[model samples]
Target chain A: MTIKRKILAAILALALPLASPVLASEQAVTFVQNNVSKVLQVLSDPALGDVQKGKLFSEVITQVTDVDVIARFVLGQYAATASTPEFERFARVFRGYALGVYQSELSRFGNEVLEVQSVQERKPGDSVVLTRISGGALSKKSRDVKWRVITIKGTPRVVDIEISGVWLSQHQRAEITGIITKNGGQISAATKMLCSQSKTCTVTG
Target chain B: MALAGCVHPPWRAKSDPLEPMNRAVFAFNTVADKTVLKPIAKTYQTITPKPARKGVRNFLDNLQSPVVFVNDVLQGKPKRAAKTLARFAINTTVGVGGILDVAKAAGIEKHYEDLGQTLAHHGVPSGPYLVLPLFGPSNVRDLAGLGTELAVSPLSFTRFKGKQTFGRVRLALNTMDRRVETLQEMKTIRKNTLDEYVSIRSYYQQLRKDAIADGVVDMDELPDFDLIE
Candidate 1:
């Protein structure tokens, strides 16, 4: 190949990949902007009614969500050892539990409006961290919830999220473990009890 | 980052419900996950979903059901009805692969109305809202819930149920999964730890009040300690 052609090829290759991350990041931004707005809508306009809001919370949020990711976090370090079966189970229970909790909280979503502070490339590759929201302090402090998007192999995935104010994973672990301990240290027994109370689980039958 | 330096009060009885020191510890604990953990969890949860996912949570919770029974006993709280419902629900869910849908379908919902909530229900007053380093947000009663419940967490079950450590895996996954779901919120909070902490605590306290009292609390009724005011 001619030198000119070779250089052109290289430029095209680099440009496309670089462009990919930007595109990917935009996709995530659009996802949250659109979907979160939907959540806010129900929150803001009480007249729209909760039946729709409940459906959105249960169906839409669940469909677009990555509960396995939350399950992984809820697991803390335990995800490493959890088998495929173990991982999957956590995802379901956690997803249902999360949905239940969120379904309860979405009523407040309208009251809280998050602003995007900044969106920047975290890595040279196709990953961008979009910083959103704030602590709303006297200085009008700005807090960030960073959404990470990158291609794993070839497919894009939202690999991580960082919220500045809390170490949610550990907090959850402590809470779950706390429940277990509070129950006389029977982790299985405690976990089962918690799940059974929820309509989302098979525990009731 | 400025919020990380304050000292944490002993686990109970602080002057302000949201103290700088307590905020500091709470902020410290939340920074990374609020920053990274939840997103990672979201990603993980998104990638995998099979049938087992349904039951794993229930199975693990069933294993932990005894704690409910014990906590009920400890608080000297009544609601033997709630206790029976919990036992039945736990039994069925654990019988299957941790799927609570069946139990829920049958009409038994999880109601962790331990002695603490009972006290709150009985007009013991929530006292002041406090945010513990690791304990997110709680009033004295819920804080006591954490303290009292910790006395019987499933960690000890790790001893006898070592054979069923599978439950531990479920516990961890549940934590990670839920964390990921809150990624967007946590990330926002991390950036403004103090403000976010205060807001979250305020909102949460109100939420609990709603959850326990009316089963549906409205935002308008809450103390609007405005973000600016």
Candidate 2:
């Protein structure tokens, strides 16, 4: 049998529910596949207005993605310095920004094929799902995207995405930190800037 | 302060006596990249289709085979020279004058060898790390190697109806092609790295070390500062 078939057989043998604490590679992959499929479907829907689509995208994305964890990570060293309210505010704005980014990226997924190749454990509680994205209109080469899934308690949440060997979280961190540093260590201004530009601004509020 | 009292980072070589001058040149290269090369590369990328760009890259690689073969022989690697000759022959004819990489498809692996690498293989030490204006990182030995390679390149002597202009255009296009390929990655690096110059320096040194070892060195063991971590 092929690897995918073998994996499916193993999952069938286990007969565990999808939300079980025992997150095998198959289960983690299923989480991503299910959400990404929904994203693609939502993106391709012709009837939905931009605002409705944005809200739907944010709702679906927040289910599988760890917004708070990613928000703290993007804050980097600034996270330690932020007040409780400042941290909450930054996280709120960052979540909206991230949702907007996801929505924009979804619009470019026309005719592209995303295949889950394998899932391998990188550390104790973290697994990376390797996916190949090919045949997109903007891409000439097939891109290898790695989704870092972190299981907290029993829920597997996507913490980061790596494309072309560079982590999206790292890029976001650098940009956000650069903005905060430029504004003389004011996270509030950066939060405002991000919120003003995000498509999720109204939805987030 | 006396030179002996000056503290240098572990990555900097004692032979790098002209570091201030080199740093100035490095700064100049950055400005040139930002103002001139980047804009041209962007336009080139926008105008050319992806497949056409690959073809251009292939053609350029095929043109450089003569230099590779000569350097292989100079390094006393008969087997490598033979391989280079075979690759060049197969790629030029079957690969349609090197517009496609059929040799690679046929399991003929590709490798790069230059006069600088040949010199390193022959026990020549890399003297002070030098940053050449527009050309970027180099050392004394590599600079000499580059000069020799330029003189020996067959493309330098090839004459067309507009020979001089043709060579210049070819060189410009080749540089632009290289620039375009790394544009996105370089932007990411620039955005992420705390100090671009120092990061590039460490990364380049590690790269050269690996190249000198013929890619046999353990990548994880490569010299790492904050650039990678």
Candidate 3:
């Protein structure tokens, strides 16, 4: 090959890979923005009752969030210790808790004006979509929240939320770890704590 | 998010029997919030610097830590109780009377346990839901539990001269601060809901349930989202 052709090939290789991440991250932003607004509409729908809303919100959560990943993350060190059944139970319970938390806090930002500010590739596998939520005439405060998004098998999902520099996954990890530590490092004890706390968790063993 | 093969029963209880009375009180409270509380909160937000307002909130939270700690113990959550106590001590001293929230910096986030939750933890069912005018959502059990907590809270009965006035001011400020924080959210709900009363009641019920569950929800009911796309 000629020198110019080799140089062109090298530049093309570098530029193509570099440009692809930007495009992927941009798509991630679109995915988050579109899904969040749709969820807000569901929350704001007057035709639906609370139960229906809860059901719809849960669906949205499942689609948008990497619940299984978050579940394992919440277990933290307990994941290594938990039996397969115990781990499965914990995951189920964690998913429910997270969905409820998200549903309850939906209205806080749902009504406000949301703007996607920027999207940055956080690491090799994930992108961060930054957004600003501005309160209307009645509210004076504005908040910035970031969604850590990752693509799994061509589907993008939110794995964490960073509100004011605090990650939701990290917060859950702290809480779960605290429980396990308090219960003397027994995952079952933590499961019992979760089962007692949450009505959704029928698995008590 | 699958409704495939699940057997979790409905978690909601038919707690509100006095819908008519609750609706009336809710209306009254709405009007009061619009005319009185909202304006005051708006003005307070406008006048107060962000840092000072945050400091005020921190201070109030520090004060309430004792209540949270007591409730944590009552709920038999030793970890939460210890964390609450540690947060209180660190915030009180290092946070400079809780004006800075140093404990948060130290990784001790706030643990918000209340007597109502304590009662729920002990299997005391949430009897008929009640909406008190100006105070917002509550159930019979929570209302009773809140009454007891208030009675026991040290901040309720100040010992210094002009104690009654001091207590009243504190209560008013706390209410106003909360109103300010939730002003936008309240406005959104009102704008979005066709029947504000029903929506508020429903939301409150669900919120209380989630709290009782310590934020856990029933995942079985969630539908498939793939069809939407």
* Residue A108 error, candidate 3, Å: 7.6
* Real contacts recovered, all predictions: 0.00, 0.00, 0.00
Kindly list the per-residue Cα lDDT of model 3 for residues B6-68, writing each as its tens digit: 433222223556665787898899889889989999999999998998998999888889999
lDDT of 1 at B46: 77
lDDT of 2 by residue, A1-205 (tens): 6999999988876876543434656667887787766776677677888879878878888887888888887776677788888888888878877776556545656556778987776544566788877775547656566777777667778777655444556556656765676577788866877776754563232
Ranking by TM-score: 2, 3, 1
Worst 10 residues of 3 chain B by lDDT: B220-229
Better of 2 and 3 by TM-score: 2
Candidate 1 vs 3: which has more TM-score? 3
- Scoring model 3 with DockQ, what do you get? 0.03
Docking class of 3: incorrect
DockQ of each: 0.01, 0.04, 0.03
Consecutive 10-residue window with the lowest summed lDDT within model 1 chain B: B220-229
By TM-score, the best candidate is 2
Name the 10 consecutive residues with the lowest summed lDDT in model 2 chain B: B220-229
Question: Which 10 consecutive residues of model 2 chain A have the lowest summed lDDT?
Answer: A196-205
Query: What local lDDT does model 1 show for residue B21?
Result: 57
lDDT of 1 at A35: 61
Clashing pairs in 2: none
Error of 1 at B12 (Å): 17
lDDT per residue for candidate 3 within A167-191, as digits (tens), equals: 5565555556555654677776656
